[model samples]
Target chain A: MALCEAEKTFILHSVEENFRIDGRQRGDYRPMELETNIVAPSFGSARLRLANTDVLVSVKLEIDSPTLEQPKLGKIEFFVDCSANATPDFEGRGGDNLATEISNCLSSAYKSSTAFDAGKLCILKGSKCWKLYVDILLLECGGNLYDAVSLAVKAALWDTRIPLVKSVVVDGNKVDMEVSDELFDCERLDVTGAPIMVTVCKIGDQCIVDPTTAEEHCSGGSVVVAVSKSNFSTILQTGGGSLHPMTLLESLKLGQTVAQRLDSTLINTLKQINDNSTDVGFLK
Target chain B: MSKKKELVSKIGLRLDGRRADELRRVRCKMGVFSQPDGSAYIEQGLTKVLAAVYGPHQVRGNRSKAQHDSAIVNCQFSMAVFSTSERKKRPRGDRKSSEMSIHLRQALLAAIKVELYPWSQIDIYVEVLHADGGVYPACVNAATLALIDAGIPLKEYVCACSASLANNDIPMVDISHQEEMLGGPTLTIAALPMSEKIVLMEMSQRFHIDHLPKVMAKALKGCKDIKVILDEAVRSHVEDVGCSTGWSNTSQKIKV
Candidate 1:
């Protein structure tokens, strides 16, 4: 991963010309390949490859009592597992810190009710609720991990199907609920308000979205902006370097714009996914 | 007796319609990731595993672990939290995963020619994306393919498989999770297929001593079969790359 001064200068020069080293515009993203419903028996699953960064997200649901504080709202938990396959540096417990940071960011991004409606997951208010466990596995780390992880998580949530509750009966604190027996009779999560994150890197005083690993190395600082349908859900500055207030504002603007575009593109692809279609997963 | 009848059906088919000796269909691809020196993905029945090999570079972290006479082969075996029907609490650093890592290193150490690269280390990591049984064997096979992709020197291909006694008489090869649950005993073996040398052998549950030989042989046979399939994949992969690179390595492809 070491880049000598000459290579850094070459990258800097390319960025100044409004062209990235990969012949992409500054605001452009790498080609991405996405597949959904790959993990069997899970409520929903998605595998997204953004260049070399590979992410697999799966949603699993379990019935449980609602939290005392959040009585009416269901729970949504994000777990990120950075696999050692991504790099030798992530061996054993080495990747736990990064995994925690990513999961926390996701939690914050989805905190707003406008962004994600957790109330819909509640089954019987305080008595029972459906807990959605959104597990994300990072298989590779090319770059722009935040953006790729968010996209895959959004897709997985969209694909998740919550089984219909047939009936519920309560008798003297004893509650019994029957879930639907039919497999296909399930309700899909409405993900229209889900947030999409975009990473805007400051490379040589210019902001660029979707920075590759090499670009990330040459950049000074970056901001991750998670944008929902109407407003920015979360904005966080990462990496070691500092950013000026003006540049930070500029990066946020850029991130929000790019995130909007990315969200629509993702929705289009998700809609195109069909079970009868021959092209599904790794067969290609 | 009633439950035992389910392992092998009334006619001859087992669960998933495979005969006792038949292995689950194996599909694999090499060079899966660009960051690693070598990487591979493998699917055996419902189980899927990804393996990546790094180094023969300088030994990393705690130089005391380095060896002067031979390269150190470090291994880590981890499964995704959502890989199975139930969520796993931890991916690695658990007792089971640590044990798996040690077993994996032992199996690979037997085949890797580590003496040639003194003061260096090779790291083999396997991530199980799905677990339906035969996880150890899948990890070993995927690592072998990744090592081959890395152009590492090896005594021979090291492959592994799991087998079990279906009834009192029939021996099943490449046992799946369902079969392992129904069957009483499960035997797993890792071997240098060409030399027919057993690097590691493990048996869980009890089986008659007479049944041991047949089940072990069946698992070894499964390993040999896997090696052949892997060898074919390697050759075809090399040929494809050669064809793309102006056919200069045409002779090399033939030799393989």
Candidate 2:
């Protein structure tokens, strides 16, 4: 939707005044509810609902050979499915494009060795490694999809437990590994330094942290920043418009600052979720 | 499949302890999401399915596919990778999923009054969150609730149920995943309960022609029982929706 000049100005003024149309400030996030270990059959699962947007993340683990290019590094892949439950527009293959876009962006953000150490996933160098398949399902789209998806993925990964391997033996080209029999004998991934993505929507002359559907439609462009604990992992500009160099630099600064707070809040919330609680799905 | 016991017997009751014609417990909630025009979640036994409806909008992609006489009914059947005992590689568009999607559309079209909105399109999406058995029937029932929640006109209530001939004698209704693996010829039927007409029917494995009449009749009876459960759910949902909208008026009267 192309907003008229008057509507654009009104939105910009509202953001500057610290009161959005949905009664949230520029720095305030929408009401969010999260639950973990909902998909019982998965290694780990989490579902997050931020206002109207809903995302379900499930993690599955498989044993596979490490990539030849990075033998020491195990693999982590992201698959995003924008289900038609979010909207009928996603029927059939309609959601494929959006799903691919989100998954590709996530892969780029986490592929760096320093960002997420895949080496920890290796049971035997070049022989056997744990491949983490992070599957995300988008059930509804209210707004701010990027933030909701990122949070759910991080929570699901934190809940994942990798079974401990007792022994590994290699015979020529054959590799054999024995996993621990005890159900509780497992290793948990250290996800304190995981990246959190924040999107800054530039509407008129103002930049807002979390934009609503109406504001998103009014914005001319937006910038997505994926920030780890100490540094920015990836920066990408979306939409068809170009931002001036100074404006782009300013937006990056905003994104990085917001992402830092987001990362801390997510870590604390996930810890509480790991304490064990029942999930109510969409009932709430 | 070798001769496994048709159903494990314990005091003349099947697994989970019900009569031969009994169905699994059904619990459902409608209008579950705000984004979709209509949404519903249903649980039958261990099977959980969510159905959502979108549109009466323009035909997406190639416009030529739109029919002039009636609105197009598009159906997509997807199961969560973790829904099964063994994880699935993909959710939809696979051979089984594609076939299920086609069958769902056929059964729904028979019930939906499509002539009311010509040249428009309606999309029904069913997501299986957990699959124990009889996923097709669960999906159809969930979709019917979602369509009503969306206020789409229907000719009649469409309900689906499955039946099986147990040990070549007793006819069982609402077979669970365990019963399905116990070696029996399974029959699934989707029918209009009011009209007493079958819209879609299918069978797996083999059954003698002489036994077909009894098996089919049992399946139809199962459908009728399911239809009553669904109708109750729809009525309760409507009451809830109406009360929420008239909350102020109702509250004022109570205060008076």
Candidate 3:
């Protein structure tokens, strides 16, 4: 997906005129399709296909003892597997670097307790807590992976339901929790404040949102902003190039605006998916 | 006698209510992606696979590995983390996936006309979206479609199938996930179906030498049958793609 200097200049000129190669406005996003509750057997699952980039997210939860340092807070871990379906380069351990980078960004974005509220995941103070494993599969990688992965994760968490715990019995340093047997008996997690990531690729003095693969290769650098409804949760700059502080601040502003819209659209879409009467999976 | 009776019951049907030699319904689509040079999606019963082919270009990495005789064929086998009943720790890189990768490369190398592009590389990437059974066969079939879509020269279409010795008496073709779980000696083979040449053959569990020949022969028949289906699919796909570029005068509009 390499772009020559001439092509880069053309893209810059188009962006300066507030247009893109695909006829999108500078702030416009490509058409996206999302589906939730795709994996019926899992606690929660969602697949987000933003144009060519496809992300499938599944959540698995289990009750375990809380860590010694974070007794009051439960655990939420992110694992991203870059399937070879995306590209042959991802075969074997080749995709490990990309997967690790995505998961690290996600863990940092959700590190703030206010962003996810792990405290609610706790069951018995220092004794027991729910561990949420958010496993992401990269089926296709067209570009804008950060934003797509975050959107899918948020939707999956929104759909996740912790099984109902009826009661707990503790005796002789042993704790037994009675989980409800009814299939529908469950408790939903609070995801209102979950952070959504927005990637801004710096292309020829202009910052663009959701850059395609070719655009990404042409960019000198990029900034990833994770925004919650309240405020910015984390901001990380990636790529080989460097950015000025003032420019970084300006990029953050752009990210903030784009991220707010992204969050609202995601919330509305998740609602629509829930209200609909269809099962979501790759069948479609 | 009781085991044979159990395999083919009063209705003389195998598990999943299919006859002994019946093949599972196959559904496939070509050019499933825009990024890859060629891409395909396939479904056999509940088993689903996606394959993408990326090259016929200069060899990547070490030039020393390149041979002047033929193009290097690279194959990768990966399963989705949630593709199975239980979550997988990793999608690939395990010994099993490595072996599958080797087998896939071997089969494709036999089918592809690699001599045309000496010192080059052709990548075949297969991902199992859902693993019911017959995963290897489905992967091979899908990869063949993708390679064709890439317009890579091929000596012939490579097809694969799985056969099982049910009740140690009857040979069942196209074993499904349920049947594979039921426990039996499963035989899998990839072949150049038209030429009737075996590219790769594998077996799990043990079978008597007398019964092995019949089971292998049955599996080869299944592979040949699948090859016909795949060939038809390739032709139809080419026709459809050809019509899309305003080359064909049919004036039929397709909504892709």
Candidate 4:
């Protein structure tokens, strides 16, 4: 969506006045609706709608050997698929660049030990571990995709449950493990330190947390900051324009504060989610 | 060898307890999104599909492909990585997905009034959230609802259904994934329910030629049944939108 000079000026002036076209202040995020465990087959799943940016994240687990360098840690991989339903422009491989960008950001954000501890996923140290495939499907693109995707990913991770292993026997380099037969015999993943990303868009002089598509188009530059607990995990500069060092620092601070608030709110919401609630996947 | 499990039991009930002719529960809602011109979500038993329609606008990417007499109908069918029991490496661009996309276009092209907007294009995208069974049929049904929500002109509703031979004697409608895995010849057909026209027909694992007519007839009946359900949903959706806009209750309006 191309914005005319006048429209861009209007958005810039609105930002300078500490107001946005969508009636949100610089720090206010749009209303978000989140649901977890919607996908029946996956280990864990979540669907989040930050206004209109719809993101669905599903986690599938597979047993595999841990990486040679990281013998004590398991693995987590992020794959983002841009569904054409979001837009015609993303029909074939057109959305690959954006998908790659987002997935890379997520992988980097979760790379740190403090952000996400993969050691708990390890089953038999270097021999066997659970590999998490975090698949994100982009159903719609309203705006603030980074924030929405991260929130959904975090929720899905929180909802993930690893099957409990009864016993593991290692005999002459051959390992055998017995998993509990009970359906509900599982261990929930610890997501206290899971990173939450916030995309702070710099329009004119002010930075905004959640920018609509129109606001994104008008913004000169944006910083995506992934905050895990109190520390910044991965900070990425997106879009074409560049920002001054002082402005970048200011935006980073803004993103960290907003991300902390968002993370706490999401954790509270997840705690309140009823497991027996009727699954309303997409029908609603 | 162990005795083969039954696709349909002697009592005529299938594995899921559905009768030989009964379809799985179908629940759907239209206009689920605000960004797209039209969008819909449909759940056929455990298989869920979401479809979005955009256009009747000027052709994108390749202007040279624009037609002089009819618009191009572009369709994309994608399944989520976690849709099936095992995770898929890629959502689309696979051979099966490409073929499904082509089949979806063929089914939709038969009903859509493409000539109404020449030199234009209509884009339809369907994403499978779950893949219990009859994925193509669910996608077709969902796309039809999205087209209607987009207010696209159509000759008639295009509904798709699957049928399979159970025990090599009885014909069953709405083949679930379990039934498909249980060794049976499955036939799928996409048809214009009102006109009784078959747009696309595909069969897997050949059966006796003598069984074709019975299976085809069962599948056609299934299509008609699905059409009725889709029509009712579309009507209610339209009525809901109309009521919300104050267009349905004209008598309540005061004289200007």
Candidate 5:
């Protein structure tokens, strides 16, 4: 992914002119294809492809006791695995660092109650709750990983169905509950406030969203902003190179506006996705 | 004592309505990704796998591991965390995955023409998106297709299949997860179908030694059948690509 001087300069000039090597404007994203419920065994699943970058996300639920600190709140954990099929460089333990970074970012973004309320997942306060295991698999890397992973996670959450508890009884220090046995008798999670991440890359003097691999290589620094509805959940600076305070503020504004637009389009697309449509996973 | 469940019904149908010798519907596609030298996706029943091949290039990391006589074939078998009904804590680097990786390498080494690329290496990676059963066999089959997609030379197509004895008399091919859990001896084999040579064979659980020959035979027959399906897919894929590129390497007089 190393860029030669001439190639870097060409990308830099393209960004300065408000155009990209892929014929995209500064705030425009690449053509993305999304599919839901591709994995059969999981409660919910999604696969998203942004140009060459591919991401798969699945949500699995398990019953467990709530933590002592948050008895009324359920648990949501994010785990990211960088598959070697994406690149040979991710072989063995090579991708651990990146996986950790991405998972940590997601956890922080979902930490705020306004972004995602964990209380709704609780079945019995202090005794039992539903633990959501959101597993993300990185099948390919074409850049813009943060944005793609977040979007896929949000879609998977939207597709998740929590089983309904018909009855709960507390006897002594123990808790017992009866869960509905019907396959489709479940409640869907509300993901309207789920955060959507946007990566703002600064190439030359201009900031761009959804940079390709080539564009990423030519960038000096990048900012990742996770926006939940109209509010910003988390903002982090990545890569090397420093940014002026004024420039940073301007990039934040840009990321917020773009993330809102992306979020609305994603919700619309999710609504239009027909449940009966045949799933064409990787075969296509 | 509790009554035992039948693995095969009296009418000669398995739980999934498949016959004793019938394999699950196998569908595959090659060249799924542009970044790798070769990539492929395969679905055998509920089990889905994706494989990618990168190499025939210089050795990476440790140069001392490079051989002077032939290329080193490296294989990795990984399953997604949510691949099974129960969520796995990690995707790979476990005992079962390491054993699978070794077995995958053993099977692939027999078919790949390693001598042509001396002092180099070829890395084959397989990711399991779903694991109904016959995971190792699916990984080996997917790797073979990915290697072919990469244009790497091979002695022949190496395919794998799983077999199990049902009702103490009938042998079933391509065992699914439900059947595997239903108390039966399962036999898996990887073979060079063209030459009818067995590359690797493994058996789990114990059965009468007299049934070994029949189960082994069924698995070998399954391998050969899979080879045919994969060959047809490769041919059709080549035809599609050739037509798009105007068939530069193909002779005009020859029927495509």
Candidate 6:
């Protein structure tokens, strides 16, 4: 995947001219195809393909005790699995490091209070609460994995439905919750504040979003800017190399602007998907 | 097991309304992905599996493992965490998955002409997206298609199927998950259907010693049926490719 000096210069010249290798402008995102309810038996699931990067996210709910430090708040955990289908290098424990890195990014993105409201998941406060396990499976890696994964997670959470707690009986020190028996009697999570990550790759003197793996190789440095609404939840500089402070600020501004548009477009796509009848998934 | 559930109804129908010798509907497609040399997706009833085949190229990693007389066959069987009704802790590396992988390699080795390609390796990876039953058999069948798509030479079509003895007299073929759980004595066989040779056979629970012949026969018959279906698919696929390339019409035209 190493590019020759001439090839690197070609990419640098393209970025400097405000055109990318994929023939996209610096701020334009890759065309994305999203599908929800692809996984059965899970509460909610979404599969997204951003260019060649493929991600499947599923949300499973479990009843567990709330953390002692956060008595009124529920928990959300992210787990990423890099399937060997993506590459032979991801076999066995070889993918563990990359999986951990992605999961860490996801968890950090949801840390800000404005990013996700964990309190809404609470049931019987400290005694009982619903734990949301967001499991992401990376099937293929073309590039811009962070952006694809974040979009999929947000769509899955939007599709998720928590059963209505009909009653909570607290007898002495014991408490039990009764959820509604009806399958459709559930509440959807408010995913408006869910973080949408934007990866800004610095190639040459200009910055670009959604870098393909080939473009990523030539990137001097990349910052993953996770924007929740109008605020920044987490900003992590990933991959090799360094960037100047002024460039970092400029990238952040670009990331925020692109993420806001991404969030609105994603919400509209999900709404349109709900009205559709068929989901082809990988079968197509 | 209180009053063990009946695998066959009073009217001689299996749990899924299939006949004693019927297989669950199998639908498959090859060349599903571009990364692997060959890839395929197969669905046996509700169970879905994707298989990918890579290489007969130079050995990866350690070079000492290469054999001069035969190519190495490596197989991995993994199930998605959300594939089943309950979530799995991990996809692969479990003892059951390891055993399944070994069994897959054994079955595939019988059909692939490995001796032709020495000092090389072939990697077969199967991922189960849905796990109803007959997971191992589905993986074997999927891998066979993928290997063929990779343009590797094979002796014959290798197929796997499961059968069970019901009511001590009736032999059922192509056991589904529901029937597998309630049926008595399940037997699975992988074979070269065209050659009428069994490559591997696995059994669970127990059957009367006298019933072995009947159950095994039923399983082998199921494999033959599966081969017919797979052959039809391959023929159609080849025809489709030929038509796209104008060979189907132009070749005949050139002859006339």
Work out the TM-score per prediction. 0.97, 0.92, 0.91, 0.98, 0.98, 0.94
TM-score of chain A of each: 0.98, 0.95, 0.97, 0.99, 0.99, 0.98
True contacts kept of each: 0.58, 0.56, 0.44, 0.81, 0.69, 0.19
| Runs in model 3 lying further than 4 Å from the true structure | A39-41, A166-182, A274-284, B1-9, B13-15, B250-256
- lDDT ranking from best candidate downward: 5, 4, 1, 6, 3, 2
Q: Which lDDT tens digits does candidate 4 get at residues B86-171?
A: 98988999999999999999999999999999999999999999999899999999999999999999999999999999888899
Q: Interface RMSD for every prediction, one decimal?
A: 1.3, 1.4, 2.2, 0.6, 0.6, 1.4
Return the clash pairs for model 3, or none: none
Docking class for model 6 is medium
Structural RMSD, model 1 = 1.6
TM-score (C-alpha) between model 6 and the true structure: 0.94
Give residue A70's error in model 2 in angstroms.
2.1
CA deviation > 4 Å runs, candidate 5? B248-256
Docking quality level of the chain pair in candidate 1: medium
> Considering summed lDDT, which 10 consecutive residues are worst modelled in model 4 chain B?
B247-256
Candidate 3 per-residue C-alpha lDDT over B116-135 given as tens digits, one digit per residue, 9 for 90 to 100: 98989998899887799999
lDDT of 4 by residue, A169-221 (tens): 99989999999999999999999999999999989888998999999998889
Cα error, residue B11 of model 1, in Å, equals 1.7
lDDT tens digits by residue: candidate 2, A1-284 = 35787877788778778788878887779988889887767788899889888899999899989989888988999998888898777877889888898888899889777778899998898778999989899888987888888889888889899999999989889888899999989888888777888889887777888787778877778988888887888888876677888888999898888998888888888876644455566444
For model 5 the TM-score comes to 0.98
CA displacement after TM-score superposition, residue B82 of candidate 3 (Å): 2.5
Predicted candidate 6 versus true structure: per-residue lDDT over B1-256, tens digit per residue: 3487767778999878998989999998887777778888888888888888888878989999999999999888888887887778998899998999999999999999999999999988888877888898899999998998899999999999999988778899987777776658889999999989999999999978899999999999999999998888777676776788888776563321
Positional deviation of residue B132's Cα in model 6 after best superposition, in angstroms: 1.2
> Model 1 residue A126 lDDT?
92
Q: What CAPRI grade goes to candidate 3?
A: acceptable
- Model 5 chain B lDDT-worst window of ten: B247-256
lDDT by residue (tens digit), candidate 5, A1-284 = 88899998999999998878989999999999999999999999999999999999999999999999999999999999999999998999999999999999999999999999999989988989999999999999999999999999999999998988999999999888999999899999999999999999998899999999999898788999999999999999988888889889999999999999999999999999988998799988
How far does residue A103 in candidate 2 sit from its true spot (Å)? 0.7
